[model samples]
Target chain A: MATMMNSTVFGTVVPHKNPTILRPLPCSLEELFCGKVKNYTHEKKIYDSSGKTFTVHKSTLQIYLKPGWKAGTKITFPKEGDVIPNIEPADLEIVIEEEPHPLFMRENNNLILRKNISLLQALVGFSFSVPYLDGSEFAVDVESLTFPLTPKVVQGKGYLSQRDGSAGNLVIFFNILWPKVLTEEQKSILKKGPLSECEYLGLL
Target chain B: MATMMNSTVFGTVVPHKNPTILRPLPCSLEELFCGKVKNYTHEKKIYDSSGKTFTVHKSTLQIYLKPGWKAGTKITFPKEGDVIPNIEPADLEIVIEEEPHPLFMRENNNLILRKNISLLQALVGFSFSVPYLDGSEFAVDVESLTFPLTPKVVQGKGYLSQRDGSAGNLVIFFNILWPKVLTEEQKSILKKGPLSECEYLGLL
Candidate 1:
């Protein structure tokens, strides 16, 4: 269960002024936080930085910090599933404006890390995200699918041949083998997984 | 760590004379199996069916089962990163294409278990891997970052209404904020922390 994953802040979060309680809202919990709000009958109350917490039955609230909300500020939110029993806390999780993976980052300063790795190996983490291609939203197990073995760089050859007096180039070639098709339901899951809270499927 | 996962297999996996182990390889061990190979370098040798065990050396082996390497023909490979003692069985892991996740496969049907679980949560019991994305990849601690007051899902309501009502959507979103970048050495550690066999800079 120990995994190191890279993520970014979506917005600025601050400390809560008053002790507060989180209640499960009506409708689907996943729907409430999928990075997009659709339809809901009730409003949820969020504590402000001024140190006051109150029950407000509104779908949305304008959040303010005593100091203020600043872009690029770091904050954290506690997971909804756990709440300390009879304890006062300002339990918080950090936030960031989630940007696309650095692989697709505007600038590829990543070359520093790619130093001696084979082009194939350097790009191993680059997932085609089969779901991304179908215009569907389901998560694809990139690990489960097959990749074509098109080895371009000869083994034992350094990526930079000219630097060490050998046939070297800064590239590794490999091809991704795409799956024929995925179910509509699977597609939807991929598209929405990163944007919303996942709901519990009775099957699980 | 506790994980929610399930799988069941009904039929038996028939072994193949030759099984190719794909490589050039990705950052993760799992990618090698799912990838294709041009020249075969290993033959399939099943050690256990229920345990999904097998071995491959240097040979042209096809992963497809049945006539070539089809479903229903269960094959076995080593658990990821598994190695033998001085025996030095081989430097690489083997892949048996016929083998399927026990829980995900029921008889002839591939079960669609719940999706959208965080990568960390999903990695609990099974031994699988993916390419390593070097960045801040932890979901548990956000001591150095701040979060936004309003969660990101505020814009998803309209989209959900249009989707078919059979299944709901799920999204896993996180925000991360960093005040500054670490030294190049620190960046390398973060990307390979969980899997690296070396001591961290602090430890040394």
Candidate 2:
């Protein structure tokens, strides 16, 4: 009987499985970067050993999301979807959805934070404290004048990929806040010529 | 002999043609809507009756651009590209490129002109003279409160489509000029309640 298991005529055949049903599991960028475990309770189907009788049952699914798990990543469960009496059960899949973070945006494994400063501060140098996921803050200084769209990037400070254990970059996007109106007194001070060429170009 | 022209052996075989070379012809949106004729003086390779030698010659290509021509629209000249010995000439194509206008942007057949107004003007409504390409002006009144990205569209004021002989539309994009700093006295005036609901939402 054990040797006959290798023969196709004696082997037991499995029925065709139904399609997959994907459910979105939304997570913030911080939660995905640090890793999290979430649970969902839903109605499931249970079948008898003979596959002739079925009943609805409540099931709790616990999902562990690793660090750097991007949106659209799927966690699948075999035959956990709708179960019919005659048809095969469908596969249940949970897809990761990245919700918009208040301060940070995730691109691949990298993180981007947009900061706006006055045009005067942009031409001159400015420094500000940047917050980390662990509630810690560090000063990121701009020694040189910064321009729009030319981000200041620090390597290996972004999310860590669990797939290959690779760390990504942290990007700081600076936006120049131009003055809506300038007084004649302020204009005279700028014309006295103490600022760099960047200031002149920005004002013009 | 006339019947033999249908046979495969008697049929004239055309040599393999080369790829197309596209040249950009940049034009202003106004020029495209009104129509213009422009000429280009370029060097052309002149091949004699035999497919053995070629000589360089100066040729002038005069192109008549039809009204309402959009960017990326192409005009083709068959076998007008490089002429090499024993090699078929490539097709020369002229692609239309829309230059940035001082006042307007084109989307489909519609023209969009962006205007900035004070926040108070946005809530209270305002009117201004909109300029036309022919140096004419008309008053456009905004009776209700306005928001960003919701433009005022006027039908049949846009670029004309030569393909279908249909007229386009004109769109006015309004941008709210929010005050950078509100005076204490001005804040009290608003708090006394005279502005519309749009102003409150904008401030918030």
Candidate 3:
């Protein structure tokens, strides 16, 4: 067994008794350089991930990266008007864990250090019945089905209706965490459950 | 005069330009009971305000509403379990105003609305930010800011933060949108012309 104690990605050890909300891991350490690493310095706001309980802001932080830059050691800042796509917020699961992820060696003679994780882990999605422009409400699912990149960012444009003549490529960040997996049959029950199965039903 | 448009609430004539991000008016009948609503009820999906995008899974939705309970109303529900107070994502903006809100309302049945509106109006506040033990995330925000109600909802126990040891009320819902009146010293710089003042450069 993996010894599923309350452990987090950042190597923080949370008490087994109390589970913590995990924060979405950023795309990469180099990516967190909100501005040019050269012009703008970096600062880390350390919190006692286990002891202190803080709420994460729901707003998406738009990162502006410099031009002509690729992911490598030579990190650069985003230039003005440069749009850094954010990870999906709905796909993110913020939590405080008991222990950080263990470090492992790669085939290349490099080491992978442990840190706080913020990104989509397995999957996340939601279902709701919202009113449409045609004057009737319908039940539909909004699944953060795929990612633009592995170790996904917290904000990214996900799937939308192609038939609707609205903005085709709408960008949004997922901030919700994934739910516990159920048997395939249980999931089917949820999908085909009675109209009154859900408790916190809200019309959008 | 501003372009004439079919107002959503109250069915009055109004100006058209940009959609308001927040408001106090209730969602219009056209928006509340659309064809999409039925599809989501039967299919268990969520339709965005644009009536275009939707998700498919229902497991995540079940976990998101774990602590909530259904009211006597068929579709309405409330939070019941852990007080995870945060803004709801579906209700991104709280209210939509078809007419501009005047600085002051006249007494009696006659109401004086604001004019020369640049966009539609709505008010919104962060509802809750809860983390599932399983790893999903959900946020709720309304379109309109209805005085103390929205703020109170934001400050409630189960909406945003899971819980902190500190007992005293925390300042989570600070008003960032209060129009900042120009200070005497700051106004003096603008009067001196944009590039004329050296101090303004540092401030920017």
Give the candidate number with the greatest DockQ: 2
lDDT of candidate 3?
Answer: 0.26
Per-prediction TM-score: 0.14, 0.50, 0.12
List per-model TM-scores for chain B.
0.18, 0.78, 0.17
**Model 3 chain A lowest lDDT segment of ten:** A80-89
Who wins the TM-score comparison?
Answer: 2
- Candidates in descending lDDT order: 2, 1, 3
Q: Candidate 2: where is the Cα deviation over 4 Å?
A: A1-13, A47-54, A86-88, A196-204, B1-204
Write down the C-alpha DockQ for each prediction: 0.01, 0.05, 0.01
Model 2 chain A poorest 10 in a row by lDDT: A195-204
TM-score sort, best first: 2, 1, 3
lDDT of 3 by residue, B54-172 (tens): 55534221212212111111232232111111212222122222222222121121222221110011111234443321245446444332231123232332212124322222122
Candidate 3 lDDT, A9-96, residue by residue in tens: 5786543332222242223222221223222222222223242433332333333443212232222222211111221111222221
Select the stronger candidate by lDDT from 2 and 3.
2
In model 2, residue pairs whose N, Cα or C atoms come closer than 3 Å (at least 3 residues apart or on different chains), thus clashing, are none
User: What DockQ results for candidate 2?
Assistant: 0.05
What docking grade does candidate 3 earn? incorrect
- Distance from true location, Cα of A172 in model 3, Å: 13
